[model samples]
Target: MNLTPESKVLIQGFCEFISGTHVAQMQAYGTNLVAGVNPGCGGQELHGLPVFDLVEEVIEQFGVIDTTIICVDPYDVLDAALEAIASHISQIIIITAGVPPLDMVQLLRKAEACETLVIGPNSPGIIVPGKILLGTQPSEFYTPGVVGIVSRSSTLTYEVAYELTKAGLGQSISVSIGSDAIVGSSFLQWLQILDEDETTEAIVLVGQPGGGSEEAAARYIAEAIDKPVIAYIAGRQAPPGKSWRQTGTLATVIGRDPNFGTAQSKLAALKEAEVPVAERPSQIPELLRKEIKIN
Candidate 1:
């Protein structure tokens, strides 16, 4: 999406004036935060923005909102997003964690039907370094540059960004699609965006061992992406053949069906795709330098 510093934003829950709340950080970063939505807090002010009872009310006051940051509780996340979708909000960033996968599945369906981009149900959200803060990505680790970063884990995303920053490599955009087993978006989606992004000269893909997203991304990069890609798959030390069943019991599998969802498989796929794979976060910038000329 064409999200910019000038994008009008709304919050689905109260932007409390306290630590750990994204309001102060986003506002301080110069985000165009318009208003908020909190039922029963209508006509009241929080974090210097008018609080309304509904998404439509916020829109009525602020006109068309380009994006919304859903800060409601986990259980209320689906309803909050649906309200935003019903109000025709084009993009949503969900900050709440522990949302049931079924709820996310429901949200994804409606989001797809409405053609809305949902960032996360348990995400740190998206950040364009010096431009705008759409979610809770620690802005201190980011700087405006040519490398675009996409990852499933928030903390790892931060650590990798910090490494890039220390190596004198900065990010054009950093996206944490969420660490949940089922997230709103995928690696390919953001990879496509970064591939088309004029500002992104290279991409750093931070993935973990869980699902098939990393392998899928490797295939896409091999086929579609023109920009140089550097990959780092976490959990290489994680035990293999241990799959978490719905009953919470781990079963030892035999062969690598579905690529075993292992880091080795992801690393191998990326290598087969000719994408440079970093054994650790510190190696990322070096690998990137080898792939693309960067100052």
Candidate 2:
């Protein structure tokens, strides 16, 4: 499925740390880097691209940008995002910096008010196959295909998509839904999109040991969707009271139970609703093959 035509993206707070990595990967995928924004590095060149002093400067130079990838420091995340919104340079914002929880909440509030489609406070950005690579995912892991992928971890998203592609499956859209607790977008949001896209025949959801997002998506599948969903939840045996490595990995502990119940519960719910929950990562391809053959 094709994304909206407006794919040109501004890389916000581009600096020595992430500029090279992001540019090389995204350029290989055919995305244009409209401009780079960094306060003090305006006149300098990075990887042969001009760096601007601010988001406003970038907008003035490059016109309005449809997307912005925020790769600034955690302390500067909110300020950087506000700058992007003020310039009206981005409708879709992907914040790759991992901000503190309190800071993330503030950012989310501002994001909602601006009506911008924010991807993460701690995400690896997004990839649309031959279109754009907004973050650091290896460009070789993706190709044009029919399965839509949404995941909480960037690494896992890359792994699943790479494995799927190697197994002869391509993705319609692969989104790494940043691990921040209060980040923007949800699996259900993407689910609706994939459900409507004729190219997307199946969906692969990668959930981590955390919040109710997976469970929420499971409920949505149970109630509204008929397409086959294959799910794999990480950190299945995480200890209670300690946050999982990623944001949103919070499960309530009860007595002797270690909250492994959460993932299992969601898996059980999906299975009950007739959505196929993969018992292991290796099973995903075979399951998809079987479903496609049967259908």
Candidate 3:
């Protein structure tokens, strides 16, 4: 079930007041925005797609969905995700942030039980340049190329991609798995997928001040992925002892200590794993050219 230009997508939180603006933007980017689901707003339409009150109804009326991009209220993210999972939706990109950490624990547990792939609980989503968009990433920064980007810093993802695109290093895909401690997806998960992707020759990882997934990804890259990876970790200028609060933040909130997951710690791990680290976004193109001879 590859995410391609033809994949049919459903917007779980479609509405007139909140998601209309971004829904319109997703439509403008040529994403196959096939249907939407908003409980009370069912029987209506957005961007020529029918609206349904339940995932079941959406499936019943419009066939199955390839992916569901969620932009609902923070509190409702778990329920929306559960609905998609129950419906056997393979790919889900959640763009809502600020969900309670405990809520994600339950959501992830269900996703695992159902064998579903969940992308975010606070993310910019995933984009396959010239193909499909599953979240809110600005499509202008992307174009079909060999490099695939996976990031935790939403804004930095755009910056690096724009720089790369401007340098003729257009990307094959760019995905943000959210920087929050208890996100639905992981860097390793996306890395593994990109590693197997024939379209992606190299990978660019963007890390941030929080989470230990970056460090973990470095280990996975060392032992697992065969593709050459270029990395840029943000918040290096940030004070120490700040990040990694969520390497297991929810776990901590649930009464466990997941210490040693800081920004500095993550950097050391990546360097130890031998993934080339970039100091600035502007320098990525040169680094890419150096690593892969793209120039």
Candidate numbers sorted by TM-score from highest down: 1, 3, 2
Candidate 1 pairs with clashing backbones: none
Model 3, 1-295: lDDT tens digits are 5587677788888532235557777788778888888889888876677888898997887777889888788789889988898888988887777777888899999888887888877787888888777777888888889899999878888999999989998798899888666887788988999999988989999887655678889999999999899999876776654544423344324443344555677789988999889999998888888778675
Per-model C-alpha lDDT, please? 0.84, 0.74, 0.81
* Span of ten consecutive residues with least summed lDDT in model 3: 243-252
lDDT of 2 by residue, 1-295 (tens): 2244356677777543375766876776677777777788998887657888887887777786788878778778788888888876445455554576787677678777877677886777777776667778777888888888888887888889888888888887788878876777888887887788787788889887666788788889888767778888876675644566666543354663554436666666677767777766667888888777522
How far in Å is the alpha carbon of 216 misplaced in model 1? 0.6
- Each candidate's number of clashing pairs is 0, 2, 1
Estimated TM-score per prediction? 0.92, 0.88, 0.91
* Models sorted by lDDT, best on top: 1, 3, 2
Task: Give the worst 10-residue stretch by lDDT in candidate 1.
Answer: 243-252
Candidate 1 clashes: the total is: 0
Query: Stretches of candidate 2 above 4 Å error?
Result: 1-6, 15-19, 93-95, 239-242, 248-261, 293-295
